[model samples]
Target: MHREISELIEIGRLLHSRGWLPASGGNLSVRLEDERVLITASGSHKGHLTREDFVVVNLKGEVLEGSKKPSAETELHLLVYRVFPEVKSVLHVHSINSTLISRMAQEDIRLEGYELLKAFEGIKTHETSISVPVLENSQDMEELSKRIEKKLREEKVYGFLLRSHGLYTWGKSIREAYIRLEAFEFLFECELRLMPLA
Candidate 1:
């Protein structure tokens, strides 16, 4: 348990250093062996996270440990863990590119013909394409979860955007998840730069 928390703390610091998490902009969580999630507490700055800055919550989003409240986006992380049993970590990153591209695209960001596409699972070549869904933002967590659930039911989601908000992704481990996060950020920046020429 301590090791898992330490890993999350390290990841939080790395993310903050990359400028993907500004202020209290993103959330990080790891699925424990017993299925409870160790997630960053609400409003805790990612750059300055401590062991106490994380809280444990069940799959239902109920707090089981720690003193602070979990992030408001807790349901989203729980949904990933529930829907995909293999996922061990879920990361929500609020980077400038994710925020901007989520707004620039109408509904989804279609990524194709990029070497970075290989960063996601099951992709070997740049010839293939995948569309990252972009949903309109809503403060109503339940409603937002429902909408996201609908997407999950229909699509092969590597990650998603909350229309001008941020990116949500999950992986079998924290390391894998962070790799995809970096890839997504790179693709988003490329797309933004090429938009004018399109």
Candidate 2:
């Protein structure tokens, strides 16, 4: 929908301004009805996206509209849609906290007893905990996607991190996805700062 596209553009600008998406280092997509998706194109500056910077693709990652090529990680977005039909938006961002904490984590980063944990859907109290999965990063999207798919089947998580790369989070809508992203960033920063004490 036009509104979703506009929201994505606005989110892109907001994320870029926060330094989460720098130099075209992130990607965003919204799942549409009929197994179609509207996604950002490769190599476009996230902060300066226009209507022309988007492409429509099917669940299979085939472009149905627009001239520009989809992001290299387009398959990853498609994988999320296939795995979670309820999810309407997926966001991938590169931030210092995410990048650092992901590398520091062995298999998954665990956050517990943080009031911010309530920012995630379903968690009503800070007594709960979440384990954000960390997958090894790779340039081969297919291979990476396969690995992620396997991990997701074993663990139902709101998000995951690509080792030394970035974070991937989704929600029922773009706004929810952005909220999760922000929450994850805040949690990551808190964890990172606490690492020295640990």
Off by over 4 Å in 1: none
lDDT string for model 2 (1-198, tens) is 899889999999999999999898989999988999999999989999999999999998899999999999999999999999999999999998899899888768889999998989899999989989999999998889999999888976999999989999999999999999999999999888888754
TM-score list, all predictions = 0.97, 0.97
Candidate-wise lDDT, in order: 0.92, 0.93
lDDT of 2 at 133: 91
Can you write out model 1's per-residue Cα lDDT over 94-140, one digit (the tens) per residue?
99999999988976888999988999999999999998989999999
User: TM-score of model 2 relative to the true fold?
Assistant: 0.97
Clashing pairs in 2: none
Q: Candidate 2, after superposition: displacement of residue 118 in Å? A: 1.1
Off by over 4 Å in 2: none
